[model samples]
Target: MTTGPGAGTTVELVKLTKAYGATVAVNAIDLRIAAGSYCCLLGPSGCGKTSTLRMIAGHEDVSTGDLLIGDRVVNDEPPAARGTAMMFQSYALFPHLDCVDNVAFSLKMKGVPVEERRRKAREMLDLVDMGKYAARLPAQLSGGQQQRVALARALITRPGVLLLDEPLSALDPFLRDRMREELKRLHRELGITFIHVTHSQTEAMALADLVVVMNQGRIEQAGPPRELFNRPHTAFVARFIGGHNVIRSADGLRAVRADRVQLGGGDLRTDGTVRALEYHGTSVHLSLDVAGADDFAVIVDEARFYDAPLAIGAPVQIGWNHADAHPLAS
Candidate 1:
């Protein structure tokens, strides 16, 4: 692709806020995204992930503070001038246009010569492996194919930062996994910053080099996926990231990974009745009805679970090492 001005630019949000009358969507949040890195703004619905992304994309106005892209404060810039391209959740390709034309639409609007625009569009299509279907309309392509076209269209601008707002949410589980790899490959090949908004913890963990977990218009934690998983700063992050059971201990609330819990071994032990069991192929998730912790759970290997096979309603002892417990802020 063509590396235009602002390519591989670092994005810095200093005390950024987005407010709508009485409702504050994105509170004063400060964040720095490194150039050529993959960052995921992760949170549940209404957590302001999308709002933050739109503000960075210049689709929404920043209510307070500065939004700097490579040292230039772009708070007053238009969407096209922000050096960012957004691929919408719905893959908003024009239905009347074919894949190539859709990918070349932006250039067409800029009054580029027809032949040159088409040639550049074809290159982007080939980059996304959608060149073979260049003549196909949106109706003729599958969800994954349409998404690829949208991606090419977004990248055609040679944006420094590619903003994806739930780009893979429309695909099936299998297709999502495949496209996740595609996104990672594209980010590496292009060598530009990528900011993806997602609600799926697994998706963020799989794709992002930096994961920012937001909750109630504030960032709960921001770090590498492994760090967030292993040492979550708050109860919301510990629970939302999954696999962790938050328990009220003698000192304070603590978080423990489900995989660290042993059936009948460890330094700390507790008796609980198995309330539910979920078969995951490689492992089994056991939900227990402990006295103080209502949502206590454990993950056991498939082989070990099948060997003993504790049934629902069976009383069992679950324990973990004291060092495995991570303290939570609240």
Candidate 2:
């Protein structure tokens, strides 16, 4: 509970897989999460991200391959023995117990003395800024406060690797943003590896030092957030990451960031009819009906957009510099 760094163990998966009867929820996939780094498993629903996390946590059996934590292969280890802790989407705090008792429950099961467990619990609550709510039941706290309690509980055992499954999905937008800051701070202070699973591209970009994009139980790309954004390897990654538009050209398929596309005046030019426009505070998001591209879009600066605002259904020429277009794998 002290404010210094905690040593985090490295996690690696080699051909890890999970199957339920004939359905392979997680196909053979390999990944390495560095010690003390924040990694996010990103994809749409049923992409095997949750299954992958569960396998690492030892909650689900790996159908094949090895799971290594630091130097040991722990494919047969129990959840409590895996040196990992999972914070579920529901918060999952015990409704009948007060905050302190909820956090101390694991220690109690381990046969730690009552006073000692309570002391450690208080320290964890203090770590999460929930010390003042130690005596309150879970039902009495707000959604955000309950989340803090759950976080404290997960950290009470001093896990080397923390696994989160959509931990922010239940909160409101404001609280989600605030909690994102708190999670980042905790990762910095604790210096522990965090493997978080989420379908939100924005959330992954905001928190992950490494982003792993999954589709159909396979990794499409895994790299630093900026690398994946600036140079996505495939059309799926470009489309799923939200801001990039995939276009088919004479040479092959390519991707261009929406902000880099201009209404006119660039090396590559195309004509499209504006289909939709959305105001997003600092920029305008415009969807266009281009011939070969589905969901073709562009982002224009607020000041520039207002200067020559194009109404929906207006025909306009859109283009991007040749340097901005990144080729994608077929």
- Write model 1 residue lDDT over 252-281, tens digit each, in one string: 999999999999999999999999999999
The digit string of per-residue lDDT tens for model 2 on 1-330 reads: 112357887999999999999988888999999988999999999999999999999989999999998789999999888888889889889999999999999999999999999999999999999999999999999999999999999888788899999989999999999999999999999888899999999999999999999998989999999999999999999999989999999989999999999998689999999999999999999999999998898999999999998999999999999999999999
Judge candidate 2 at residue 259 and give its lDDT.
96
Error of 1 at 134 (Å): 1.2
TM-score of 2: 0.97
Which segments of model 2 are wrong by more than 4 Å?
1-4
Residue 280, candidate 1: Cα error in Å is 2.2
**TM-scores for candidates 1 onward, in order:** 0.97, 0.97
Backbone clash pairs for candidate 2 read none
